[model samples]
Target: MIGFIELIRASGFAADVRQVKLVRHKGDDLDMDQLRNEGWFETYQCFQSKPVFDGCTHIVSVIGEDATASRFVGIYEVQGSTTASPALLPEHCPYTQWGTESRVFYTLKKCPGFEDLEDRVVIDWGKGALAWHQWLTDRTIMEIRPRGRVLAPFRDFLRVHLSFEDLGNLATQPTAHKDWVAALSAVGGIYLIVDSMTGAQYVGSATGSGGIWQRWCDYAKTGHGGNLRLHELCREDIARARHFRFSILETFSRSLARDEAIRIESFFKQKLGTRVFGLNAN
Candidate 1:
């Protein structure tokens, strides 16, 4: 069988190939529930260190507790890399909470997968189906397909609740994802950016001409939406600003007066105690 590494190289990528990883993160509970429900495809995956995965092109994710070749998730096509404090790790990848140092970060695009053909066997590590695996040689191959049930189908649709990690894609990808743009654009309203790093919240109003979508687009582009307080926050740490979760606290008609929205914003700030003890400067 053509091994997984060889298959990728034959597909025309020239970057250094790393061994396919069977990421069975023990004790990490954050992303597991979502992965179990959604079939585990996303734009970002993180590592505790870069040196181990440096100069790599891709990581083939597998799901399991032990290194047994039970199942393969899918391939993550590497784009670019950057590092941030463990605090900046997305809610989906909270496994980094165990790390005492900075974590490796990358933007990974999902490649096609044969979920139907993956994980048909459960080979012992370094023998049989998993024999190709070797420490320090991640490009190692594994069984073409284990014989058994493997995956739940990917949802292939947008969900209503927006996640911080998904917001990054909204900034870069087109609006065809549907729910984010449509729901956010449908009304002008009061929204909140909750800082996951420290639980600081910023109350803001989007009662202007373009509504919440336009306002959020400003935030996605500039990481601050031109708010002086948020501008300062971004200046101090852009990653923190990018990790803020955008949620609508309440919605109002697009025709609502802008002044009324500002009042509502202030009301929310006072009601929520954001300005006195949070990120809001005004």
Candidate 2:
């Protein structure tokens, strides 16, 4: 239960405590899924309908991911701000059109001395939605997960759901998500990979000694997992792999035979029409 300000000071942020504001940003008016999946959160936070940060010299930005927990984004030094206009929005702004004219567009630059702490720190934002912005001096640190937070804890096979980014993170930083990796490695299973961009799906199985964990790690590294269709899809454009979402279709006990796992995988491929209508070619 260390104080968040103490961590900031320890990290070499020499600014006065009074000049810092803790801002927990959530997307209520925007498409949060798209923001998270497509990287629109920063622009969304940069321009807000209200001047919430008017009096702050520096703001510690956090993205609200849970009911009272927020993941640290970064410390931003406020350069200046202006009344939002249609022309003020960047071309990549998620919205098709802007109808609100009362918004404020902030000009912020990433503050130095806090780069190592970004995305690795989480703080307990004291209960309540009304106080999204508060003086930094009033808050305390909650938990600092190494390599940042994983998608979620491993509850059961049915609860397994991961985006491409999540799989990559788990594959690269196994210790941070050891529970999930351990669970995945303990049993072979049938898994599903869907392309969110085209809604194309591929059903596959993992029957090797390393189980589903090893299979997914291959996908994370090569973006194909040695599948013919997946390799072709990624060969032309590797970035297309970012649109993939992974989930478990069925789990099999370690004693299950390799043919049995493949049989279950084939059933799902047929049920989902993945062979003729989706990404699966075999």
Q: Quick one: best lDDT, which candidate? A: 2
Question: In the order shown, what is each candidate's alpha-carbon RMSD?
Answer: 11.9, 3.2
By summed lDDT, which 10 consecutive residues of candidate 1 come out lowest? 150-159
lDDT of 2 by residue, 1-282 (tens): 568878888888887768778887776765343466677665666677788878888888887765787877788888888887778767866473542577888888887877677767877888765688888765667777776455545678986768888888888788888888899999888899988778899998987788899889999998888999989999889898998889888888866888887788889999999999998888
Top model number, TM-score: 2
Return the TM-score for each candidate structure: 0.50, 0.82
Q: Candidate 2: lDDT of 14?
A: 81
Task: List, residue by residue over 4-102, the lDDT tens digit for candidate 1.
Answer: 545545655344443444343322445442443333334235544554445556655555434443355555666666664656555665344533356
TM-score of 2: 0.82
- Judged by whole-model lDDT over C-alpha atoms, candidate 1 comes out at 0.58
Deviation in angstroms for 213 in model 1?
0.7
* Model 2 segments more than 4 A misplaced: 26-39, 89-102, 129-131, 147-159
Give stretches of model 1 more than 4 Å off.
1-164
